[model samples]
Target: MATVFITGESGTGKELCALAIHDNSARATGPFIALNCGAIPQDLLESEVFGHVKGSFTGAISDKPGAATAADGGTLFLDEICEMAPALQTKLLRFLQTSTVQPVGATRPRKVNVRIVCATNQDPLDAVRRGAFREDLYYRLFVVPIHMPPLRDRGEDVIEIAQAALHRFSVEEGRNFAGLSGEVETLFRNHPWPGNVRQLLNVIRHVVVLNDGGLVTLPMLPESLPRSVQPPPAPAAAAPTDPASSGYVLDSLIGRPLAEIERIVIEATLARFDGSVPKAARALELSPSTLYRKIEGWRGA
Candidate 1:
């Protein structure tokens, strides 16, 4: 059977991609088992993958079907395969060479038809060069290579993805949100999402749990976000056609109530300053305390 190898930064959903492959394959109805090699103890890692009979080693109290055997006629997804010890790699390579599984302490190997799909957050070839991963095993499992680009590279897909997460998290947390504000969308688009989709989901979860209804505004975002994320530049203001309009754009403020107009100006300035009220206040020619009082009044109103 052919194998698939996925490489991506952590939180880029490599395992999720592996599962998707398994689900879409001809063996979709069969078992789809996954193992995170790095999470298991080094001593018991072999036994965990290949299984062990009763009393085979310290905690092997009963017979166990390893991932390879249990996933027979289906798929076996090994995450962080690069973390597997070099010594145990031989046994794993042997199993891959022959569609057979030999459990630890077992006398003989048994045949099993399982498609191998493995992933690592690091470069598998680099691991081979560093002697962390076996060269032959790398070649064996790299039949189909999948490189999952980080979220920052995915462009406006982040907007749709965040919205989807927002909707799902909203229902789960019993929070109702219309959607992200235009400023938030611009900020999200400009941000370099180092943590990918997982990070985006976590942020949506945080927002859904903390705030109630309405659009997710810049001020509502966690403070840590503004430091790393910057919003897109606003359109250049139209030249003053009327001397009465001053330097500020008055097109959007014409029919609005004074309170609403003030609120818009304040919030727009806050967004420009990455949600820093201190900086926004300085720009607006008001004391920080005065700005805080006004914002609090708006919240209550």
Candidate 2:
């Protein structure tokens, strides 16, 4: 079976992709094993991947099968693969080459058939260049490379995923939400979802838990997400930067007064959160009353 490499930003569903590969492949009925190489202690990792015999080490009470033996005739998903120690990587490479397992405290190796699927949030080639990962192994598993794009760049998918998550979370919380309000939809579409689908889920969970029912409105959103908020369209006379460029210029600040700059920043932040002063205040680390007083002062001026 061909080894597959999945690379993407964290929370972009690498594991889900790995599972999909296992499910659709020829070994669909066989056991699909997943192992996080980085999470296990380095000393025990060899045994974790290759099994161990009785009394192999201090904790070895009896013969135990590692992920490799456990995943015989199926797929073994190694996550955070680049985090694996260099020394153990050599052994892994050998195992991949021979299609065999040499359990700890065992004198000989046993043949096993299994497909390898690995994932890393970082660039594996870059890791090899930095000498953090084995170059040979990187190329060995680079047969199939899948890169998952960030949520913001996926067009209407943001809204679609949000709607699905909303329904799921609403049912879990025993609340009913028809869908997102138009303003909330625009807010979601315009904002850069840095945390991707996982972030959308938590936000929906917060919305579901706090509110009883109805469409998801701005007021139901968490106050702390203001940093990711995007401001509304500017006036035509302002002549803002091209939307495609999404570039922010700091040159105009050179000649502006400090108070004016602060006001500008506050107003921009407020607009991003749809004029919700409390959410903006929390994002700017200011008290709500302080934000209120500043806005009143700005209007009074």
Would you list the C-alpha lDDT of every candidate in the order shown?
A: 0.82, 0.82
Tens digit per residue, CA lDDT, model 1, 1-301:
6899987778888888999998898999999999999999989888888888888888788999888889999999999999999988888899898888889889988999999999988657668889999999999998987777667656789999999999988888788899999988988898867678888888888888889979999888877776346543442332345677664567767898998778777877777776666678679876444565565466446
- Relative to the true structure, candidate 1 reaches a TM of 0.74
Candidate 1: residue 270 Cα off by (Å): 36
Q: After superposition, how far is residue 235 of candidate 2 from its true place, in Å?
A: 21
Stretches of candidate 2 above 4 Å error? 231-301
Q: List the residue pairs that clash in candidate 1.
A: none
RMSD of each: 16.5, 11.7
Cα TM-score per model: 0.74, 0.74
Query: In model 1, which runs have C-alpha deviations exceeding 4 angstroms?
Result: 227-301
Q: How large an RMSD does model 2 have?
A: 11.7
